[model samples]
Target: MTTKKTSIIKVALLSLLGLILIAGVYYAPLIQRLYFSLNIEDEASMPENLRTLHQYYSTHLIESSATPQPFPRQLQENVLPESFQSHGETIKTKAFFTDAKPTGLVIIKDGQIIYENYWRGLTESDTQFAFSVAKSITSVLVGMAIGDGLINDVNDSVTKYLPHFKGSAWDKATIANTLEMSSGVEFDEDYSRTDTDMRRFQMAYLFDKPMEDFLLSLKSNREPGISQGYNSMETQAAGFVIRSVIGERSLSNYMHEKLWQPLGAQDNAYWNVDGAGMEVAIGGLSMSLRDLAKIGQLYLQRGRWNGEQLIPESWVLESTTPSKPYQMPGRDNPLSEKPFGYGYLWWTPVDPNGREYYASGLYGQYLFVNEDKGIVIAMYNANNNFNSAPDWWKERYEDFFQAIAQKY
Candidate 1:
């Protein structure tokens, strides 16, 4: 071959290699997280839960071409709770140093707004991601379905609704078990770098395959219902049971009719849809923080709103009360692990003076309700340190709640 031809061939090969390198870097996990925070709509390869969540917020929560509903207001108050003011200062300091953003914070006491704040360029009008806070919402919907006779009972096997799971490990699991996170399924919830089971699950859900199929593919790590383990996939299984009970309706539509419209939500919200168009019920909901507070308010009033019983009063009480005794499942149970216990998609703090439970999520998302004091506090943060934040924030929130309780 001629020298000139050889030189040209070598240059062409090098150029191709460079292009491939650039693409890999752009698609790396860190780059993906950065890209998702900015251009969420275009990043379609995210976890099915996240992708659906983004689609929901973009399409329904915003006041844009797709959604035209005016924000609704059940009630509004101007007074700032003294407790919230003091706690806000502490949270602000912690958040600034930890590379996290607080999207919104709200406190409701005695049916009046005591405090409200927003950071990170989010306003009362902007909808923020719920992370796993959506799980609590799903839990509420399950209660509603039970009240309406759509769901027969919590003890009913999941196979009753989802027959595809009839022969699987889930067949022996009850709806109540799943809600309590005691389904005994061996699934990992870690989101660290590399190919974890969670990553595999995300890939499958995002790529448009059946979540049920993916779930059934999991092997049992423990005997069914022997212990409690926090597994996001179990929540997805709960969603499947809900879908089975209310066939032919979208999760968004069901939520709209049962909760949003009835509770008079200030804004429309969205649920991320899977490849089969099923809402990613595990943790794919997005809504304004103020509106999110309204959800907590509904529970505060025992599921009653505007002289109507939106959810069964009995169901609400049972759902919030801890079902299991306080104990750790694994050997390395962190001190942050609650000794108080867990309810239906809610976490109870180990406070002896006052009974407090909350809908909690990774990255500092919380909807804390203290029935003893008639207080409901909602907060959203973008912290990624799920393990550390829960323990640390619980203490901060308890202190905040105690100060507020003294006033009442």
Candidate 2:
């Protein structure tokens, strides 16, 4: 208990506190991101998280055009059907929304809004997270890149643009393969498992780790272009390829210039970025439901918007068509949840007419297009059971969308 010994102990404690303070200061942003990444999908807070995702992550702005195009509202009366058949069972339309937990729903026919609804305190102005629908956005950007001559061809090897991936898993993969989710890069898309690769990828961004590092370090589980497997990392690689070709520009900036502005986006969009400022091309986009419907409407119109061909018509056809045998819809495909075929970041239902395709995302986000009927349906939801939901649930929604299209 000597005075000199007590002073020495006090000095040690103060020095330790100083080091801790320095670490905290250095890691504050990362810690905050990690905290949000972990809690954003909590069952109780998911609705609020969907509404305010831009506030929780670092984002790049996809600015709206000066001349914003608005959807004309027709506002039909009692348009939704009473029931729809799926898996030979008739389900009530009201129960679909209850089960899906939709926050917003907009149905556009012939480029006019026929029905729009919002729940869980969401409004027309709110920009809910698009989840994996951003992948479809990235697909459109890729098509634009090809049309602009920035990218030589979709069949070009990814290493042609990204030299760093020359010896990586993507060495032999083509850009088209990545777009088709056939890159063979091993990434678990399952979100329920904490030990899965998807969880690790989440942690990578939460801790400010370079997403490219994680992407480049992966090894292919199978040969490229053999079959479809839902791998988000492949989309990230595609984003990197787009970044490489569009020199001196971020994906957000490129998308804004080539797609968002040209398409006449009404509201500003937000895209989450990794620590290295790379847009999370897998699933990061956020925008209002009307703007989301605009994406579908554009495709429904064959990639033309207001007399302008924003996306190539050829690309749109290729994006929705499954050319490969493995890409066909059946019970044999690796991830055929509901007998729907795989296209370039899009899904094709088993309709005999073969005119319907859509882009869907985690937690029940959908941007559906019925090309034959000229219908577009945009939906946002916070379904807690998305991971565990039965396969028939999605098919049921598809049937409902088609029913509405037929009714209109």
Candidate 3:
């Protein structure tokens, strides 16, 4: 063969090798973990819990082939001032939005819709994923279960509902501990690596395995209620407790009857389910940005809507206020970094100057409520990249809240 032909063939081979290497890296478990970390599934829908999972999944994750109806424009058209603009200029210039495009933004003030916008093919009718914000919603459901006497009390041991856990480490963990994220389970929340138990838990939910089985596999790293760790598995366990207490009601059905329909949600929302038809209460919820804003407004009004009480007034107050101290096992708690404390599943900003608390999710999904100023902002973004730096969300959230505070 000619020398020129040999050189060309060698270059082609090297190019092919590089392409394969790139493909492998992109499709590797590490990449999958990154994606899965942002994707929350209903633990009950897992295959091992088939009957429960099937029932939950069918009711929650409804995939309508038909187009979804849009929310009333009047619901959001008058909330903001005519000249008002979001921190869009800052967001566009920032590296965060450049990497992760926000799909939706909705702001409600004084029970009035003010501003709404969508980006990157998302619309007012689209049900954007909630990520970990579902944890906050799950917390609400737990409170509802308590009100209905489906569950006795927050202090009740988890094993009361799931007898299988009677002798297990979680047997003594109380519903309050899980709700407050004080469960001292021996699981890592680290997402930087793919082999961590966090990923394994994600795998369990993704592949539809029993969440309790996954929790049972863990050894106690710390005594229950002694420390705080962001254990997603604990949230799954909380879901199980809710199911066991509520008996036959699917998570979606409960939410619809108790919260959604009552709040006058403009559109149907979807929640991810596990193999056993259990709703993944930790964060697999998906709903329109406007509906999410309505949730914020509901909380802002202390669980009241249209002069009626949807959720217990006391439950809303306690759930939004910080209950546990901000301390982790070996690390400084991020909640301490702020002026506010940690509540049921909400993050209270420490700035005493700002009455702001939020339901924050992986990436940039936030349901920020500033009750004193009567402002509620719901933002949805695909920011899986920001999961590692949760503080990143706090910074932006504070900035936005500060701006809104100025407006009011």
Give one digit per residue, the lDDT tens place, for model 2 in 216-325.
Answer: 88998888878787788888888998999898999999988877787778889999988899999999999989888988988888888778888899999999888887
Better of 1 and 3 by lDDT: 3
TM-score of 2: 0.94
Give stretches of model 2 more than 4 Å off.
1-15, 333-338, 390-392
| lDDT for each residue of candidate 3 in 326-364, tens digit (9 for 90 to 100) | 531112455333343567777776453455678887667
> Please, what's the RMSD in Å of model 1?
6.7
TM-score of each: 0.76, 0.94, 0.76
lDDT of 1 by residue, 1-408 (tens): 699999999999999999889888755644554455444323123223232346422222322223233323334453334323332454343544244345677777777776777765567766666878889998998999999899989888888888878767786888888888877777876654446778787767655566767889887766666667778888889988888778787667778878877666766576766666777777777777777787888898899987999899988888878645433222244521344456788766555346566777666677888877887888776554444545555556545555555566
lDDT of 1 at 130: 81
Query: Which portions of model 1 show Cα errors greater than 4 Å?
Result: 1-100, 326-340, 384-403
Higher TM-score: candidate 1 or 2? 2
Task: Write down the lDDT that model 2 would get.
Answer: 0.84
Question: Best candidate, lDDT-wise?
Answer: 2
Model number with the top TM-score: 2
Q: Which lDDT values do the candidates have, in the order given?
A: 0.68, 0.84, 0.69
Off by over 4 Å in 3: 1-100, 327-340, 352-354
